[model samples]
Target: MPALASDVTVITITRRRPEILLRRCVPATGRQTRPVDHLIVVDDCPGTAERLSAAEGVVWHHASRTPDDMSGPGRSSRLRNWAARQVSTPWIAYLDDDNEWQPRHIETLIEAATAAGADAVHSERNVFHADGRPWLEPIWPWSADDAEGRSLYREMVRLGVAEPGRNVIHDRVDPLDIADGIRMVDTNEWLLRRDVLLELPFTETLTDVHEQGLLGEDDLLLADLVNAGVRISSSRTASVDYYLGGYSNNRLRHQDPDFAWR
Candidate 1:
């Protein structure tokens, strides 16, 4: 292949949300502190690449997905996997269409990866309302009563992520334990080696399997990396603005205090 142009290529997977893709996601990536070398926005819509006409740095690539990819499970992972294959950079970072990164997000991740000599790095994200208001609880503890949340909480505790009566997922993330910790490793918060991700691929999660209402490609990917002994690092600070009303948040819109933090 031709020589890679840059160290990191940010990937934003968008659908028909031209307004958000053009207005929020693209602009946020454009304003990064380190000046992104490449930005590839993968759109499922056929003509969205030409229609978006995004900023200069953005390379809009339309995913001509197969029928199974569209109608079957793991559409998110499938689309992301396809886009990642087209990356021409050494590193690949993800920023979903509904989210925005802090100016130092990419810069911070690169520093962390270099310092730790790691294959992948992750950062923190605080919850914000769709209208730009930060949520009261940046991170919340899993309740001991709810069976599902209880299991998740116990697993986190076993992994040393949280303690009894203490919601401890503030900055640190142990790759081996992050998968069991509920809603911890988000796709938007990761910066991984392009070759590493491609070799492992987004094979786990719902990308190809159909679980009963189980959706966590991020967690599955983390599990795979940990299993493969990938050297993962953490920035340990909130660098991404995780806006509410996205896929995960909207699905749990009816829940209790765990709404935003979960």
Candidate 2:
């Protein structure tokens, strides 16, 4: 049976950062206008799980820790896959431990997906500094000085899709124009169907970061969706605050001189 589009479960994975996860992401879930039906917090650290267990409306689960899952960009996909199995809601959304959604985040994305008859839909995100503001620095994060941020910002600027202060990074991925290279489909900006996620899980993402030293699980997932002809669209509204300089950002590419995601 095709699942109804109304019910939604949010999957958030954290390894050790309880402070931000509790302070930001959990509250963001509770404050959602659509009122999340389920909020799954998968953590590998037992100590972190203990700290987050008391979080209201959050079901904390302890996942088995793998050496590969300890640090890197691709680990998120692995953690998300772990949490996806536990979700019963027909609609599924993603949020990172270090990121936050506006109160209308769920409401906005749901409306867009339903209206477009899309299997998955995404929203724009404002790339903010650690102090909770958009990039206003002369030494911009999106400048050529930063390898990762520059790569992301360059594409978004050419596309003219994002407008956060001076620099723009997160926008929306158009499957039709996906071959053109769009950096807008960050993990937290998307809402997708549970059936679609299960049918095409991001299982092999760890290799992109852990082995190859290239950070690209989200891109691969988007490719999978496009290849499968999943109806994907974008809300074109900036509903997420993707904060930089978080714990994971520092350690995304933990090893190798070749590649680093942050």
Candidate 3:
């Protein structure tokens, strides 16, 4: 049986991107096949939420941040964690302000999770340039095709070439195992059970700090979930269109040699 729309809540954390939220995220979310029970927007920018028109059951929250608040890495994680607490649904789906989901995204993930008995589920995404041209190459780690190293690790464990106790892939293969994986999953592509998320909330700490920029609160949260014996079901069908624009993180990546755009 398919999960009811009332069973899931879609949460979006945005800061000063009202145009993108109104033009892209809002419409796409409204089109979900399994309509969400509620749409929660955690707006960090003051006065931005008021510009958005009201809809029945759409909840808007403005994050209270003091002038002394740390503005770097864990900001999004904190806002998302706060929003998760406001969700009364069984499942929580996340969407960034700049990205748009296909109508079936929530429907697909919910069905997949129900069938697999997974605590979390994620789907592959199609990447596009800001002008809307498709970026043909698979986004590494997010797309299963690029998981060659993970596949190799799993094979090594099965052949006893690598000890199961020492391998990360072994954790995902068995629900009871709680070892961290060698790779990180994309935060935006996942849908998680609300209770599971509450149990292992996103850590409000930075995982990467460089002179160029800071990163990885999302990676830390995913790693924590994987380490807590959460079984994730990933799908290859691309249901989200990730737009690579002049966002702050993308701006930093454009200048960083290690993450230069191909």
Q: How much RMSD separates candidate 2 from the native structure?
A: 4.6
Q: How many residue pairs clash in all the candidates, one count each?
A: 2, 1, 0
**lDDT at 183 for candidate 2?**
41
Model 2, 74: alpha-carbon shift in Å?
Answer: 4.1
Q: Better model by TM-score, 1 or 3?
A: 1
Q: Sorted on lDDT, highest at the top, how do the candidates line up? A: 2, 1, 3
> Which candidate has the top score in TM-score?
2
| Candidates 2 and 3, the one with greater lDDT | 2
Model 1: worst 10 consecutive residues (lDDT sum): 136-145
TM-score for predicted model 2 compared with the true structure: 0.81
**In terms of lDDT, which candidate is strongest?**
2
What would the TM-score be for candidate 3 when compared with the true structure?
A: 0.72
Per-residue accuracy of model 2 over 1-262 as CA lDDT, tens digit each: 1232338888777766788888888888888889785455555688787876665545766777554344445456666876777667888888888889999998999889989999899988777777777775433353324666666554555667545455345576654665675543777888999999999987454543434333456667877887788888888788988898643344443454433342
lDDT of each: 0.67, 0.70, 0.64
By TM-score, the better pick of 2 and 3 is: 2
| Every model's TM-score | 0.75, 0.81, 0.72
Superposed model 2: Cα runs more than 4 Å off: 1-6, 66-69, 137-144, 147-155, 164-170, 175-183, 208-213, 246-262
lDDT of 3 at 57: 44
